[model samples]
Target chain A: MTHGISMAGYMFVNPGEEILVPSLFWGNYNLSFINAYDAKIKPYNLFKGEGLDVAAMGAELMSEGDKKILLLNFPNNPTGYSPDVREMKEIISAVEQAAKAGKKIVVICDDAYFGLVFEEGIEAQSPFAWLANLHENVLAVKVDGPTKEDYVWGFRVGFMTYGIKGGTEALYTALENKTAGAIRGSISNTSNLSQSLLLEAFDSPTYQEEKKEKFNILKSRYEAVKQAMKNPDYAEFFKAKPYNSGYFMCIELKDGLDADVVRRLLIEKYSIGTISLNNLLRIAFSAVAVKDILALFDGIYSACKELTV
Target chain B: MTHGISMAGYMFVNPGEEILVPSLFWGNYNLSFINAYDAKIKPYNLFKGEGLDVAAMGAELMSEGDKKILLLNFPNNPTGYSPDVREMKEIISAVEQAAKAGKKIVVICDDAYFGLVFEEGIEAQSPFAWLANLHENVLAVKVDGPTKEDYVWGFRVGFMTYGIKGGTEALYTALENKTAGAIRGSISNTSNLSQSLLLEAFDSPTYQEEKKEKFNILKSRYEAVKQAMKNPDYAEFFKAKPYNSGYFMCIELKDGLDADVVRRLLIEKYSIGTISLNNLLRIAFSAVAVKDILALFDGIYSACKELTV
Candidate 1:
């Protein structure tokens, strides 16, 4: 997925050009966009009132350059949130408004967490589908893989698909050749053994059923996290961010309580690990046992209390 | 191997700077140094007569530039030639002389075909061992992998090693961090499954013996190719270049014969495939069976006759 995103930067943006990502995003975006391509990272607010800030996205799109790169990842890392159907439509509408205003937009949908949604009423499909054929001026590039989807973190297999309204075979062929050139110049090629395994796994008779079983296991853990966050005592320490569909959820620490202080306390006192990001504590519920979810929260609650004193 | 080379380009060479390569080097050097890093490729004559041109290399090193990147590939591609120990020392002496002349050098030893030396009196070990720690002003970088070494091409596993005189752990660590940063910005990490498999293969009791068996098979093919090239009939068509190691050998077309025309004729009439580069045809004798080696060369001879008529 990172390879794909970095290629987008190579293919589209020149040095010092801006790529707009969310304010809270995977930190590796800095390495890919800035370090790899020498492009600038322009961040926009990700959320407004527990939903995607479509207004902020639209504003960034129309604010400056003739060519804009809007990178969207969902359910995003650190703060797992996937937009519901209405929000998806609104996001697309905002992009459409920008495209109609003569902005040449490249919408990169990083669907690393594809099909991991655990909640109903959320649009589980990738937004690439809707934005693909929306406008001639807009190009939708999807970077997805079985790394997260199939639990093969080390396989390092990922893909990039390009979409544009009225895109011809010649255009896609040219784009593919350029992408191949970029890859050929770097790693030579990806792991063929890993790719063959994925192909065989996809063709298995029980593949879909097995995947569903695993998804249900993670969904149960997500439910356990949701159930534990309802505790009244924990509310004073931190407020849970809007989350539904991925492995992680963030909690915004209240009263300026140091998240690193709480994180260290949890690690030292309770042997629990959580990533502290400024005022946000990202808890990867996927790694914890479903039965231990409540105890994990209790540990965090105690750590926050200790920091308060 | 490419990743390491690209990283060396990224870390050491700046844009518009020059990277010295052999005139008959691998074509992908263009992609890695020129396309990826925007560095210039300055080619030096690889051969004088049948052996390596150490004088040409020395001349390039003492050229106008203060900092020079010298990339050397042993058991080199296209013309599979590795230097004997005496010639290697001469090459090193040339570099050391240039370094003493205040030329800061980064010598990249691309040892992709390491351990494949077929002839006696040849230096089988990588030149990196000698180049490393030779001088404080020279940094030796070695890029090699199991792709060719262990015959696991699809696994895509390679490594990069750095060495310098009086280098401390802190300096190595800093270089490692920068390399890791470059990888993180791109593919994130190599395939863990492939790496684990390579580890197991390395640990297996039959590993060395099995590898010896495979090496003997390829060596037999190389011997068969050498024996078949002794046929006087082939001299009318092409003269084989000096090759004693690696999977490939090149034939320089004789009497102004078009290599592509002969290649097409061989493919059309005899169904034999070979890569034609200008007046040279590269044949991978490693892929041909020992029993069929003579026939393959005969096919080429016949095609050349047809082309002449």
Candidate 2:
């Protein structure tokens, strides 16, 4: 997702141009744009109390007054927020309206978590599917991999796919040549040996079965986290951000305590590890041993209360 | 080498600044600097009939009149020319003189063919050893890998080491952070699995012995190539570029035949595969069998005569 953001940043948005990201975004996106491309970040509100604020996002996109990149990372890292189908359409419509106004729109859909859907209403599909040919100026780029989908991390393999509306095959070819030429200039290519492993995994008879088995386990963990948060005791220290899909659920510190301070106290006091971003504590329920999911939140509850104002 | 070029390019040279490369050099360097970094390539004469043209290269460097990057790859690809110590000193002297003239020179020594030396007089040692820290204004970067050195192309493991004169360890540390940050923005990092494989290769009991065995075979092929070119029949068609220390050697056409045309005809008529660049044909003897080395040149000689102008 960060690599996609970086490439899109340099390729599409020049230095000093504004990149409109949701207030809630993967931290790496900042590094990707600002550090890598020298582009500035302009944040729109991401939530109306844990539900996606498509209106604020649309308003920011429309009123930004310049051509910009729309980077949408679904089942977003840290927050694990995925837009439902209608919200996804609203996201596309914002870009479409902006593009229709003669503004160049580079819509990058970072689908790192493509199919980890546990929530009923939210869609796991990428916005790129419908938004790709949405407008002529919309250079839709989809960055994805079986790295997260197939549960392989060390592979370091992913792809950057493009779909630009009203572009000829020749145009796309040239764009591909540049992108690939950039890759050649960068890492040559991803590992051929890792590709072989992924290919074999794709061909294996148990591939779907194995993937389903892992997906179900993750789904169970999601349910466990939901149940864990239902405990009344945690309400005093933090407010749970609505999360139904993906690996994490964020807890906003309610007593106005610093998240990192609480995080340190949690480590020192309760021997629990959690990621503190801004004022939110992110809990990854994906790899939490099934038996320990509830106990993990219990630890968080105690740590928060101990340091509460 | 390409990655190092990309980093050294953006870090050292500005967008429009020119990079001076040898006339006979890897094609990727052009793409690496220009496509990725927007830096242009300025070619210096690499050969005076059969050896490194240090004097011409030195003159080009002196007269170009700008703070420039001098990129040199030794055990040279496609041409297989490694400078002897005296020639290397002459090459360093060019940079030294340029630095003395207040031109900030960033000398990148690409050591891809580090240990694959087959000649007695030529030094396979990196130019960074002597050039680095030699001048206050000169910054030296060496790019090398186990891909060619350990005969593990699939691993794709390489390194970038820097040496800047009078540079404190703190400055180097900061430079490293920026380099690492830039790399993070591009490809994250090289595959750790590949690193593990390379580490194991390093630890193997027969590591040095096995490398020596492979080195001996490549050296034998080099001798075979040098011996095969002694045929007077080949002399009429093409003059062999004086190659002594690497995988490939070039044959400059004597009869003014189109190298690309001869290349196509050779593939169709004699089932020969060789790289055609400008008026030269490159042959890699590293992988060719010793017995077939003579036959390969025979095919080239025949093709040259058949396609003669």
Candidate 3:
């Protein structure tokens, strides 16, 4: 875990440079910056709809030149809202422009919840695979591990790589040597056993069949929660938006209703716990049983009603 | 693994500091310095008869202040030799004196082969348990894993901690937080399955009995190898010193005989393979059968005799 983040930090920033991260990002990123690399991190706010404000992010990058690296997590955490493809393209374009202006732009695509984008025909394309080969100055890094994807959190197996690039063999060699040097220096080597198990799992004849079934189950649970939120009692408590994929969704509360207070009330008063993300209450739909989703929402609805009065 | 090393690196050295290591030490120590901490490594020579040259090491550290971090490996790999207590004390005292002189000394005791010291009664004590309490500026770190000790290599379980003066709550808190941060950042958490197996192995009622039996088997094998080296026919080709414990013994070749050439000749001509360290060949008595000890030496004896003229 430390290796993965530190590796990510080394890939994104140069010595004494600053990188931009979303304010609502995973907390480990902060630790990686301070503990792994002595670099600066600038936080950008997520827009009202819980997506990257492309215009604002572009402006920040434009102001900073190539000294800025942007880290994006979508099917975003704490709030499972993924931006539209148009928004993603805009973000990539802004990064490309920054790269063209003699600045090194590293884009870290953390596709943890990648395949679970909920909306039909709204598949999330990895910016890494797209941008890697296109621009020389633009370096794309993809950090994905089997922990969440394979539902094997204990495996502790992850992979990092230079997204598709049109680099010479020498360039690739240097990158691989440095990465291997990093791996060699850290824990010596990843567990050969873990790597073997992951390889076996991936190569299993039933892998695709198993993966599809699991994905459908989580997808159904997410849909159930989205539908349950439509009940009038809960409707006033949440601002509904298009939620296509992933295990979680965000509900923005009415003004004067603190998400933290509501979260505590839900836990203490209703024995239900949800994560508070600023003004939004993020519920993990995959964690609870599908049959219990309606009941869970009922508790949230009651808590909101009690708080409203 | 990477996180473990990175944290280990931090535990020993400060940012931009230099660490001294033996060329034969684990490759990851170099990785930890270059990849993880951006620190430099000064490689020192391992003496022929003695393991590490204490006087030369002292000369190196005397020039560099107490800010020097040294990684010491015993029953060393590629060449398994644990220094005598007198030599170890000399090294420790030098570091201690440097610390008292206002140098910050961090001694990382890579006790991977802690219990495997071959010499009877001359086994090195863990500098870890002593250094923590020795001086305010001195820190002794012990890095050990159940891999070698418990014969559970696939478990990938190990521990890192300050052995000496970390008795205070604040010290404990800082150590815990730093280690946790490293663990959280790297592999997230080690395999819970691996830890469970190790815990169970340690708690097994017959654990000590099993270990003792294995130790005796290795001891018998070591004695056989030592006895075989006493043959008049082999005496001129090899020189054997007192090796009371551990899995391996060193064989010093006669003058003008290269260890690497002799090793290849033994392998190709006699189908025996051994690790060569300069003019010395390391023979693993633990894994080799007692019955084969004479045959192994005869092979070496014949190879050296054939090549001598």
Candidate 4:
């Protein structure tokens, strides 16, 4: 996934160019875009009342220079929020508005957690599917693979696919060659053994069924977490950020509670693991079995209470 | 191997810095250093009397700025030349001379074709071993792995090792962390499955013996090529460059014989494959069996004649 992003960074942005990233984002984005490309990051508000801030994204897009690289990751890392159907439409509309205003845009759809959405209302398809052909000026570059979808974490196999409204075969071929050139200039190529294994796995008779089974396991965990978060006792500690998909969801800690302190307490005292990003406590429910979901939240609540005392 | 070089390029050289390369060199060096890091290539004469021009190398290092990046490839690509013990000493002396003159040098030992030496006189150990602890001013970085040694091309597994004079564990750890940071900023990590498999292969009882068997096969092919080159009839067409190891060897076409023309003729009339780099025709003896080496050389000779006609 990072290889694809690195290539995209090389392909699109020049040094010192601005890339619009969410204020709350995957930590590696800093390394991929800012560190590698020397591009400046312009952070925009990610959420408006527990949903994607589509209007803020559009406003940020317009406020920036005419040439913009807008990176969207969903189901997003750290937050684990995928846009619902209505939110997806709003996102497309926002990007479309920018394109209509004659802004040249490269929308990077980091669909690392593609097909992992648990809820029915959520948009199943990536923003790549919608914005790829929505506007002539917007180029949708989707970076995704089975690394997460197939639960093959360390395979290091991902793909960079380009799409644009009215995109010709020649255009895509050129983009592909350039991407290949970028790759050639760096690591040469990805592991062929990993690629062949993924190919073989795709051809297996139980591939779809197996993926469905794994998704169901994650979905049950998501359901359990959702149920557990409804406990009124936990509300005084942190408010669970609106989440319905992917591996994790964040708890926006109540004012005056340091997430890191709570996280350390949870680790040392309660033996629970969680990532603390400022006040947002990210819990990767995917790692924990469904049976452990309630205990996990209860542990966090206890940690918070202990910290307060 | 390319990944390690890419990391080295990032670590050592700043944009527009000059990297000293051999006049005859691997093509990918341009992509790795120049394209990726925006560094400049300063090519020094590679050969004097069919042996490495150690004097020219030393002179170039002395002539350059105080900081220099000296890249060396042994059992080198296309030329298949490895410095013998005497030549290796001269090379070391040259580097030591530069280091003594207050030059800060980063010697990149690209030992991609390590352990493939078919001759007795050649220096079996890499220059990395010699120059690494030679001087405090010199830093030796060795990029190598089972990719070539074990012939696992598609596995995409390689290692980057660092050595320096009076090096401490802390310094090495710092360098490693920086390299790891660079990797994290790009591909994230290598394929774990490929790594696990290579680990398993290394533990096998016949690992050393199997490697020896493969070496013997290549050595036999190398011997055949050497024998075939002794044919007096081929002397008029081209001069065989001094070569003893690696997959390939280059033949410098005699004046008026275009390498591309001879290559085409070989492909069309004789049904043989060879790479043309200006006047040098590279043949991969590693791919050709011992039984076919004579025919391969004869076919090249025949193709040269046809081109001349």
Q: Best candidate, lDDT-wise?
A: 4
Classified by CAPRI criteria, candidate 2 counts as medium
* Candidate 2 Cα outliers beyond 4 Å, as residue runs: A1-4, A64-66, A165-167, B60-66
- After TM-score superposition, the amount by which residue A184's alpha carbon in candidate 1 deviates from its true location, in angstroms, is 1.7
Candidate 4 reaches a DockQ of 0.81
Q: What is the lDDT, from 0 to 100, of the residue B11 in candidate 3?
A: 55
- Tell me how far candidate 3 lies from the true structure as C-alpha RMSD in angstroms: 3.9
Question: What shift in Å separates residue B148 of candidate 1 from its native position after superposition?
Answer: 0.7
Which pairs clash in the backbone of model 1? none
Off by over 4 Å in 1: none
Give, for candidate 4 chain B, the lowest lDDT window spanning 10 residues: B300-309
Q: Which ten residues in a row are the worst by lDDT in model 2 chain A? A: A1-10
For all candidates, state DockQ relative to the true structure: 0.80, 0.50, 0.50, 0.81
Candidate 4 TM-score, true structure as reference: 0.98
Taking the tens digit of each residue's C-alpha lDDT, what string does model 1 give over A1-309?
877777777788788889999888999998988887788999989999888887998899999778999999899897999999999998999999999999999999989988899889999989899999999999999999898898778998889999999999999999999999988888888899999999999999999998898888899999999999999988888889899988899999997698888888889999999999889999999989899999999988888887777
Q: What is the lDDT of residue B206 in candidate 1?
A: 100
User: What 10-residue stretch in candidate 1 chain A is worst by lDDT?
Assistant: A1-10
CA shift of A246, model 1, Å:
1.3
TM-scores vs. true structure, each candidate: 0.98, 0.93, 0.84, 0.98
lDDT of 2 by residue, A196-284 (tens): 88899999999999999999999999988888888887778888886777778889988578899989988888878889988899988
Query: Which lDDT tens digits does candidate 2 get at residues B1-309?
Result: 456666666577667788888888898887678876678888998988657899877776677566778888888887988998788888888878878888777788888888888877787688999877898888888888877888887666678889988999898999899888777766666666888888998999999999999899999999999898889888788988878877888888875688999899889988888899998999888879999998888998888877764
